[model samples]
Target: MAIWVCRAGKKAVYVEEFLKQEKIFCTWDGFDYDLNLYDDKEKLKEKIRKEKKDAEPTAINTWAAQLMCLKEKMQNGDIVLTPNENSKSYNIGIIIGVYEYKSEVPEHFRHGRQVRWLPDIIFRDKMPQYMIYSLGAYRTIFNLKYENEFVELLAKLGIPI
Candidate 1:
């Protein structure tokens, strides 16, 4: 029962129905979403109504497809963007790595020193992690711990996801 932010103007009339219908076509990222109300349990609960029985699976597929599509683009280092309907706001981020790793710091260095080239890269577990265009100057690396932020980044891209 995720609360979907909807325009509070004329479009509010069709929120749930529109979501039910659009789930068949695209990922439904709320537009003009009121972030302040996002965490308001009672408020959001009041705004989000259950979809018709059949629309439920469609919604789940919509979610999975959204995740899969974003995952694919992420494998290619693409960012995902969810543009606001008014075109004034967006959510952006990228996924930069798979399986986390230890620093590989040697016994001597674990306490202080770090070797220049001691880390290892595993191929099978690798996912084409990404860094946002904004971070290009900073050199996005595969080992960054920026919080599955990259996934949010995939949403900001023009890709289908």
Candidate 2:
């Protein structure tokens, strides 16, 4: 996905339309964020200027993202899930499954990772099938490029694995 930075004031809305993009995140400070909604440049720019605009990462989110990334890389069968040192404490047991989120999870338990303390994650496609830890939460799957980043993130989080 591509990200863009635009100046505020007069041309913001027009620019948004011209760019064929619709979803806008109002980063304006002191304002409640409306995700998946549209906002003009002034609002977003004010957010940029205030420095209180965005949220800091929480441990849960960071951990969730890392797990999801690893799940995507998994192939079916038993595998060693290497965590970044910050989060290596997340040792898990044998994963007895591998499938996409949509097909695998039961309908009653679909709150993403939020609902489950330690849901199994799996990547549907790969050399081996995944154990499937973060089934509902992965926005995108991991490829080779993210391996180092995952390790770094977990290491920073304090996991030795």
TM for every model, in the order presented, reads 0.22, 0.20
- Taking every candidate in turn, the Cα RMSD to the unseen true structure, in Å, is 20.2, 18.1
Best by lDDT: 2
Per-residue C-alpha lDDT of model 1 across residues 1-161, encoded as one tens digit per residue: 01011121232232233233221112233312222333433333333323223346545444333323322223323322222333233322222322111235222111111111111211211223343232222211112334354434333433223
* Candidate topping TM-score: 1
CA lDDT of 111 in candidate 1? 12
Stretches off by above 4 angstroms in model 1 are 1-55, 82-86, 91-95, 98-161
Candidate 2, which segments miss by more than 4 Å at Cα?
1-55, 58-61, 79-93, 102-108, 111-161
Per-candidate local distance difference test: 0.27, 0.28
The count of residue-pair clashes in candidate 1 stands at: 13
| C-alpha positional error of residue 6 in candidate 2 after TM-score superposition, expressed in Å | 41
Residue 107's lDDT within candidate 1 is 20
Residue 135 of candidate 1: its Cα lDDT?
26
After the best TM-score superposition of candidate 1, give how far the Cα of residue 76 lies from its true spot, in angstroms: 4.8
Residue range 1-161, candidate 2, lDDT tens digits: 11111111132322222122221111112223321132344444444345443545343344334333333323433223322122212222222333222323333111111111122322233212232233222332222333444445445655443
